[model samples]
Target: MSAADAELRQAFAQLQAQMVETQQRVSALEPQMAGLQRAQLHADATLQQLALAGAGGGGGGGGAENRAYQPVGRAFLLQPLPELKAAAADRRSNADAKLEALKTMKDYLERTLKNSENNLREMVQQRKEQASS
Candidate 1:
């Protein structure tokens, strides 16, 4: 094969490898993303419930001393402990980092894949021109 063909083939192989790696990274992140979404949803629901309870009681004696709002088993408390809040913040930061990494990988793979396609098209055009001449 000509030098152009060789270069094009090498690029395709590298692109394929990058695609595979990116796919695996995305697959690994899927579960973590789902879990984070679920946790955020639960926290939002708990906050909404607290808001509704407050609205119903009009900030009276029943508002602050809600026995029903006692958090249990992953229930996000409106006033979480300081340590617990710190830990949760750390978890959120980690999740955000992973999500950003996944997005970067996806973008890189997309650009590289497009480059491979363009390179192959150019190689084919070159071959056609050579044949015609």
Candidate 2:
């Protein structure tokens, strides 16, 4: 093959590798995004339940005594209910931010893949024309 053809082939291989890596990254992000969404839903439900319980006056203000147990590895730690709620809110916010970042990355990768495919096609066409000539 000519030097130009070899260079084009090398570039195509690199782009193919990058496309596979991007696909893997997107797959990894999918699960993380789903987990975050599930956590956010759980947090929202917990907050709603707390609100309802408080509005119903169920236990006079003993809700303050409510302790939330947080899991740490194989153990659990006792935290106040309000503090747990705050932590859950923070987790939800962080998950949302990460999800947004992943989405941006996915978009960029898709665009790059499209551009690379177009370039590869153009290079192949040029090579064919050169061979014919």
Candidate 3:
């Protein structure tokens, strides 16, 4: 009986540790999710600006086509409106993909945490029942 109780205690401690680890992982992903969301929004705005520029340049003879001043590593380059739009779209898609992956990971971790808690509770209940008997 004592050995069984000791085993149960050890299991409970392990479950608690697992829950804590899952919680930490979920917490760490939150900031990354926020940053990705912000980047996506920025990309969206850039795309919108590019669209407006393209539209305005279309109605008038503005050097044949519109161009966007995009920043490079340490300099600005005049890029075609189409190229800028494509780049912005790519950024948005990448951010969205990363955000989705992080969200899925966080969800899985949360589920694991809940399962651990449930297992811990069940163990305690069983221990109580055994003691009562």
**What C-alpha lDDT, on a 0 to 100 scale, does residue 17 get in candidate 3?**
90
TM-score for each model: 0.49, 0.75, 0.90
What local lDDT score does residue 95 receive in model 2, on the 0 to 100 scale? 73
lDDT of 3 by residue, 9-94 (tens): 89888998998999899989999999999999999999888877887775556633777799999999998888889899999999
Superposition TM-score, candidate 1 onto the true structure: 0.49
Q: Could you tell which candidate, 1 or 2, scores higher by TM-score?
A: 2
In the range 93-123, model 2's lDDT, one tens digit per residue, is 8878887887787788778777877877887
- Higher-scoring candidate on lDDT, 1 or 3: 3
| Poorest lDDT segment (10 consecutive residues) of candidate 2 | 51-60
| lDDT at residue 126 of model 2 (Cα atoms) | 82
Best by TM-score: 3
With a 3 Å backbone cut-off (N, CA, C), the pairs that clash in candidate 1 are: none
Clashes of 1: 0
lDDT string for model 1 (92-113, tens) is 5665676677567667766765
Q: In model 2, where do residues sit more than 4 Å from their true spots? A: 61-80
Position 26, candidate 3: lDDT? 90
